[model samples]
Target: MESSDLRNAGLKVTLPRIKILEMLENSDARHLSAEDIYRRLIEMNEDVGLATVYRVLTQFEAAGLVRRHNFEGGHAVFELERGPHHDHMVCLDSGKVIEFVSEEIEEIQQRIAAKHGYDVEEHSLVLYVRPKNRVAGKVGKG
Candidate 1:
């Protein structure tokens, strides 16, 4: 079924491509760079190379099966574009990422775009932040 989806999207149905697509679709870590995907493949004992991961991800992005995000980091991260739209919040301290959606924020963006005499084609909002209040023994960002 996944291979058919890939074929429909103009991609060759291959083992590495199918495995990478599965990882992107099913991972708890929705946003991942090519390096991250490569690490995951290695962890799974798959022989897919890092260069293959990068190439497959780029192909997926071009085919609109995935979306690439360039957060504050120099590297780019890719996410499967198969769900509702949402923005991201990144914790600077721990490199944690959170996804959120706000109707009010969306309205504000639309209004701003209208005011500027341009239809909003797309928008990406990433808020880089840290904890407001620190709790003892709390070292993780949520």
Candidate 2:
């Protein structure tokens, strides 16, 4: 992928880099684990190794091309960094990850920081939740 985004990130455009970037951007699943990416590559008949996927994803994270989430599990999931910031809601039952943004939450964070006489530079909030009915436990995001 000969992308200006790649060049600006100070990364050389290679097949692996291009394919990985494309996969992240085009995939319907907003977040993906490295194994998910590797499996997709194999399904597409792309000759990308799992190790190479890890390496490329790490490089992208370093370059600010993607953001990694260490949600409850030790495994990390990655999403392309398209500029807006949002928090996550993880479904404890199904292990689903949902992305959401709330103006109220954002304001509350800033207010809390100011009350402490400290400016907010950055923060991450993850809400671990299960279905209200628990019986259904089908995680979903609106």
Candidate 3:
């Protein structure tokens, strides 16, 4: 992903966009909300406004460079488009996200769509889970 790609998509390559993209690129988390991104940016001393982060994220979503997810209540989160399609499992207690690929689930989805005579364009699946008492370092699969 390059900044010029945004320009090609008719979006101006602004500092906030660049910084947000960079942070997203370097992030290990699979899901990040606008507030989370803003906090990270502030920690880096970028000082970009939260609204700016949200606007840039919306632009990125419109450009198809990022995907927005609503796994945790009304707050929206984003993830970069990378590899094959997958779903998410969010830990309710820790707010950790886990990515998992399930062929069985995929087949079931396809069958359901076919049964309804509808070609699936796009879809998102998010499972909310609670971890057993383990106090693990991180609570998610890649």
Best candidate per lDDT, number? 2
Question: In model 3, which regions exceed 4 Å deviation?
Answer: 132-142
Per-residue lDDT value at 14 in model 2: 92
Q: lDDT values of the candidates?
A: 0.90, 0.91, 0.87
Off by over 4 Å in 1: 135-142
lDDT of 2 by residue, 42-80 (tens): 999999999999999999999998999999864999999
Clashing pairs in 2: none
Q: Which ten residues in a row have the lowest lDDT in candidate 3?
A: 130-139
Candidate 2 segments whose C-alpha is farther than 4 A from its true place = 136-142
Cα lDDT of model 3 by residue, 84-110, tens digit: 999989888778888999999999999
- Structural similarity to truth (TM-score) of each candidate: 0.89, 0.91, 0.84
Error of 1 at 89 (Å): 0.6
lDDT of 1 at 15: 94
Report, for all candidates in order, the number of backbone clashes. 0, 0, 0
Cα lDDT of candidate 2 equals: 0.91
Sort the candidates on lDDT, descending order.
Answer: 2, 1, 3
